[model samples]
Target: MWNPKATVENALILLLLTLSVMAKTVFSQNCQNTGCPGLKECCSSWGSCGIKDDQCGFWCFSGPCNLTNKSYGFNYNVSAGPRGPIESIVTPSLFKRIMSKVGNNCPAKGFYTHHAFISAVKSFQAYKRTVAKREVAAILTHFAHGSEGFCYKEDKARGKYCSPSKKYPCEPGKQYYGRGPLQSIRWNEYYGAASIFLRLPLLKDPDRVAQSPEVAFKLALWFWTTNVRPALYLGFGESSKRVDGRLCDNLHPNDTKNLVNQYVNLCKILEITPDEDARSEISAFWRRHLSALMKRCASTRASIITGRYGLSFVR
Candidate 1:
């Protein structure tokens, strides 16, 4: 029994010696006092210093530390709206992030990987300043509905969209129902114009638009820049008038209201309030417009607000 205690003490001493040696090696090799570039410099998991949130927050070894909340003192005032400078061009990553909220349920999932869509959006010179992101959001929202998530062709069509226009005649056995983002509904007019602008024989090979992601987005860009941008600058009502020419007319009384709801939804997704406060104004707009428009459409029976466009079920 006396000998057993001595053996246990010897083992404990050996273990302590090994641990001390290992600790010294670890400290000398890795834990030396190294300094970063600046006090703001964040030490990332990859052992590099960076300024972006991706680098400093989530990528840091210590986990997300809000440097802004530290003694450095940075505060954001959401109540006052975007106080910081806005980006003129919509970066691909930013666009993808925003669009994901809108088309989360879409079949293709997200924005197509091509320069055409971004290029076309950037070409809108008038809307490039503060309203660029808003306009782009609006266009994408409409496209999400019009093309059903940028589908190349309409899913359901009775016949080939062959136009009988003599000026832009449909080639033999060719159909131009709804190709590309704006659907490019008719061949002789819409498809014809796209073909001329793109110089890709879109008239004969209408499927090129559907097949090529670049061409598909290009068609959408052309439509938005040429036909819709001017009217849209004024408001949704003017934009509808330009596109359909009968916004809330006898034919579709609730159509404008329904469309407004869609626009509001888009604005909400983009975090855009009416007066630039963090508070959303679209809800107020909906309350004022939705009920009256629903009543008017309900009586006419011509235009009915359905759940498809985010309208609540009518009583």
Candidate 2:
């Protein structure tokens, strides 16, 4: 009566069946309009239904949808970026103005130039389906605050931020302090990786990040495109966590719920409205007031009731 072997076999069959269901695949084009099988599933570039990174990876539908995972920003070639027309909502002039206002006295010169920064941003924007104006503003605001409103590299070198690994080695007599617009903390790994991706020898000469404005901007863009943007799409709280790499409560120890206050403050400086909660609240308030007013009028009909005796008021 106790056939444990048969029961074990049945359990194994069910497990295999569940695995098959979870690993479903589809073409990205097909899922574009219809969407994936599961609500949380995103269609991979290879046309597979998957969750998290699998669905939002580099191969996902490259369009103006803003659905691609921005958790880490993606990079694309000047010509072969996303699939659609790359329209920069933040005009070149506006971008320059913002940079000048927020950046330090450093000139956007040498290898670190404005042209390079603009080109890099254009390429970065191509990866996203829809680039919100507020998002663009937020990027500038964050950089401005991070660098104290300047294209600055930290003056006091704390020490070499070299990793001393076989993959990326520190040059003898060279130090990698915080460099670039966003001030990358440990330059060896982060800058080294970005250098490899960008086909530059930044790891060999880490100082280039500080010397060149374009390079500095590129480093900032790389961070934003990869780590910052994706988290921001989730929400301010998620973005902060991504930036801080810890619990929201830890970041704002005094008031965990107020963790996104810095982001909110930056938004205010940019004059970008906060998320739609305020608008929704205003709408609800008006509806309630209108309903109450109508009810009061209905209950006191005598106040303005239609009467045969001329326009005699009754209360």
Candidate with top lDDT is: 1
Quantify all predictions' global Cα lDDT against the true fold: 0.48, 0.47
True-vs-predicted CA distance for residue 127, candidate 1, Å: 6.8
User: In candidate 1, which residue ranges exceed 4 Å CA deviation?
Assistant: 1-89, 98-111, 123-131, 151-155, 240-262, 265-271, 274-280, 287-315
How do all models score by TM-score?
A: 0.52, 0.49
lDDT of 2: 0.47
Taking the tens digit of each residue's C-alpha lDDT, what string does model 2 give over 149-244?
564555343566554567666677777666666653344666666777667788788777776677777777776776667544444333333332
Q: Which 10 consecutive positions of candidate 1 have the poorest summed lDDT?
A: 30-39
RMSD of each: 26.2, 17.6
lDDT tens digits by residue: candidate 1, 69-133? 22112221212233211343345675565455545555444435536565554444543444444
Superposed by TM-score, candidate 2 places the C-alpha of residue 201 at a distance from the truth, in angstroms, of 0.7
Residue 176 of model 2 has an lDDT of 63
